[model samples]
Target: MLFKTLRWSFLFTIIGLAIAFLYDGVTGVTVTAILIVLEVSLSFDNAVVNAKVLNRMSEFWVKIFLTVGILIAVFGMRLLFPLVVVFVTAGLSPIEAWDLALEKGNPDTPGTYGYILNDAHPLIAAFGGMFLLMIFLDFVFDEDKEHHWLGPVERALSKAAAFPGVSVLVALVWLFVFSRIFSEESADMLLAGVFGIILYLAVNGLGDFFDGGLEDELDDEGERRASTGEVVKATGKAAFSLFLYLELLDASFSFDGVIGAFAITSDPIIIALGLGVGAFYVRSITIYLVHQGTLSEYVFLEHGAHWAIGALALLLFVSIGPHIPEVVTGLVGVAFILLALWSSINYNKKHRGEDHVVHV
Candidate 1:
């Protein structure tokens, strides 16, 4: 099952490595390998969260995610997005930005491709941070969420859901505080943050709007009560919303990594190839979790992924001034996931023993 699921990732890895080798021989290959590890480490939590959303999707949509979605991820975000950002922010034409990228100018020097991209980091961080923060807020503040990974903390947050728009209030407060702290860029930061919040609300509200009818057709456990054709139709619409949400979410997560990749290497092609492989692996992992029902088995896993997202959001905010190591970002996520997995295993063991005693 694992091999079947990850076959594409394996294929991509080989292709990415080959391109890297041809581009710059062994050194290129090595950097690309490092980038793959970097992308995977930073996005493991993303895979878990993706599985939660993807599980509800039909097989047809799932296939779409693997094919069309991968193209968007690899080329659109990894390559084109950065170029576009530099084009707009640095007042360069798209061709000029692309040429600069190919020239592989020094990242630290002024007026270079890398320098311009890094200069735009604050806006990127603000936008991505707020988007991710909204996600974290919605997950923790969900009143109907039965599972509690952090117990008292999560429960308290959930109870606070009684106050309408409390999450938005908290997010705005955070954004305000951070914007004040970085006074020079306060206006830009605020504008980007507000845009992020609005984008999240728009996408999430639409997803929920489309999903409402589908929900009515499902029982408590999410099995369909509607005819298969009806469910498929609903799923198609709902899945498109979800697919847009997922793409945006992935973009938010990729901002830091894409920026950080410049620190490692200035070669856009290498970065694209390496990170593309990692993106494929993340997709594969998402599919694997859905196929094997991992989230259902490891009940707190979703909670953990959200917590990691919260941490990443805060890290993005923090990274506005002082540089936080990519390693630090990656480790924080892995730690949350591991702790949640351990707790889930213990819970299962205790419950299984109780069930056995009752049976006896």
Candidate 2:
């Protein structure tokens, strides 16, 4: 199981080094290595959350997640996405945007790609933060959810789900405050945040709507069971919906990393190589969690991931106007993950002698 989990990790590392070596001799390799570590450290929470979501997907979709999905993650998000952001915002042609992305340490120039990309930081933060905030809120506020990792706090939030749109309301309120305090382009930030919420609602709504059509039987938990036949077809559709969600979720998470990569190296090729390889490893970890049933066994792991996400959301918003260390973000995520692992070990030990261990 361990080997399977790390199978692609080693491969990705090799690929990363080769790409870096091809791009910029010895220095490129060093930058790429750093970026890969940065990506993994910052995104461990993302992998955890992804595991929970990926657990429900069909086998075929899981295959897609590994195969075709890597392309989208590596190239679409890491490589071209930044260029696209710069192009759309700065009115730069594709070639021009690419060149600007390669340019390093230049001050803000009018209509330049670096200037525009940097300027979009607040907007990116607002969008990703609100979306992640909504994800955290929705998870913690589910009245149907019985597992409470934070005890009183989680229990209380779970009850709040009784109120419709509670998550959205909370997200929007926080977004408004962030827009005012953290961004000079306050209106743009606010608008982006609004769109973030809308996007979340749309994706989640579609998933829920698809779930209803997916199966005839509902288990004791009330989640639709993919029994067979038409239900199986619906499962495909549902998986597609979730796939889209996962991809977008990945995009939201990558915004900060992509922007941060520019600070490490001016070469877009190195950024893509490092970040893409790291992202591939993350995908492997998610699959490992799913296959090993790590999420079910280590109960608080999901909660810790969500909490880390909450932290990341706040960090992104805060970093919009301030300089927060990347190490800070990475360390915070690692802390939660380690804490959860410790808790899970304790939970396992305590439950080992029980007749029926409640797998919460």
Candidate 3:
């Protein structure tokens, strides 16, 4: 079962290594291996969330996610995205940015590719932090959510959903507080963060709007019945919109990992090849979790994943003011995942034979 599930991962890993070897012999191969591991460690929770969303999408869309989506992820975000960032931020041409990215020096020192990438940390953090914050908010505020790993806190957050736009408001307030707390030089980051929040709202709002009338029925009480919607049967335009959402979500998670990769190596090709392998594994893991019904059995796992996302969002903002080790970001996510797994085990032990469990 595992081999059948992860065969694609194996193929990609081999391809990535071969590409790495071609890039610079042993040094490229070693860096690529390290980067692949780094991406996986940093993105385990990302796999869980991707699984949750991908399970809802149709098979065609899932295939597209693996194919075209992988192209976008590998080349667009991992490689081209940084150049775009440098171009926009430093007013350099694409070629100049690429040259800058290849400049070798200590990552901590200025005038190197790593330095330029790391220098944009605040901008990257602001965008990622806001986008991820919205996702975390949406999950915690989902009124239909029954399982809770952090019971009291999650339950309270859910109640806030009663107020429309509370999530946006809270996210904005967080951005506000962060801006004030950070140095005056970082005040501009709030604008970037707000734009991130806006994009989340726009994208998710479009998704909800597109979902209109899909699963609504009147209850005998003359009120709209609560929708126990099954997996989406989306097609055409609906599928496209969902595709956009998934890609944006992937982009939000990728921001930190891509930036952090510079700390490993500044070669764009190596970064793309390395992170690409890890991304392939993430997709495979997502498929495995969905088909095996891991989320259904281990209810608290989703809870933990969202909590980890929330932590990551906050850490991104906090890192704008203080340097945070990439290891810290990766380990925090792992901790949340493990804790959620443990909680799920305990929940199963407590409720061994419930006649029913919530599927969605």
Candidate 4:
């Protein structure tokens, strides 16, 4: 199962490494390896959340995710998105932005591609941070959700979820606080943050609207048993809505890593190769989890991933003024996932032993 799922990822890793080595010898190879590790670590939670969404998608859309979705993630986000950012933020033309990126100049220097992109970090962070915060808030604030990993804290939050637009209110308050604190870029920050919130709400609403009647068709275990052709049509529309949400989610998560890559190296080629390969593995993992029913089995894993996302959101807001170490970001996420895995295993053990008991 593992080999079947990861075959493409393995193939891409070899190709990415070869490209890196041919581009800049052993140094390129080393940087590429570091980037793969960095991307995979930072995005493990992304995979978890992706699997949850992907679980609902049909096989056809799943293939689309592995193929067309990957193209968007690699070239679009890793490569072209940075150029576009430089184009817009640095007020450069398309050719100029492309030329600046190819120059591979030092990030510390003014007017370099890296420096411009880094300078644009506040906007990127604000936008991505708020989007991610909304996801975390939605998951925890789901009043109908039965599972609670954090116990009292989660329950408390769920109780508050009955209020309409509570998540939006909290997210707005968060943005306001951070905007005031980073008053120098307060206007830009608030604008981008509000846009992020709106984008999340818009996509989420579309998904919900398309999926409105889906719950009625599903059985107790949430499997669709209906035979109506209309159900099939609705399913496809819902899947497409979900596909868009997933793509935007991927974009939000990739924003930080793309900007952060400049700190390690100014070469966009290497960044694309490395992070692209890592993205393949994340997709592979998401597929593996969906196929194996890992989330259903592990139970709390999704909860942990959402919590990590919450932490990352806060970190993004904090990073507007402070320099946060990548190690700190990666470790916090890993810690939550590990703790959740342990708790899940224990829950399974206790439940498994009870399954064999006979009732009087």
All models: lDDT?
A: 0.90, 0.83, 0.83, 0.89
lDDT of 3 at 143: 81
TM-score of each: 0.94, 0.91, 0.92, 0.93
All candidates: CA RMSD (Å)? 3.7, 3.6, 4.1, 3.9
State the RMSD for candidate 3.
4.1
lDDT of 2 at 151: 79
Model 2 ranges off by over 4 Å: 105-112, 216-234, 353-360
Q: Which pairs of residues clash in candidate 2, taking residues 3 or more apart in a chain or in different chains?
A: none
lDDT of 3 at 148: 60
Task: State the TM-score for model 4.
Answer: 0.93
Candidate 3 lDDT tens digits, 97-128: 88777766577887666777778888889988
Q: Would you list the clashing residue pairs of candidate 1?
A: none
Local accuracy of candidate 4 as per-residue lDDT tens digits, 13-93? 999999999999999999999999888888899999999999888789999889999999999998899999999998899
For 87-187, candidate 2 gives per-residue lDDT tens digits of 88888889988888777544346555556777788888889988998898988988776466677888888889889889988998898888778546799
Clash count per candidate: 0, 0, 0, 0
Q: How good is model 1 by TM-score?
A: 0.94
- Global lDDT of model 1: 0.90
Ordered by lDDT, highest first, the candidates read: 1, 4, 2, 3
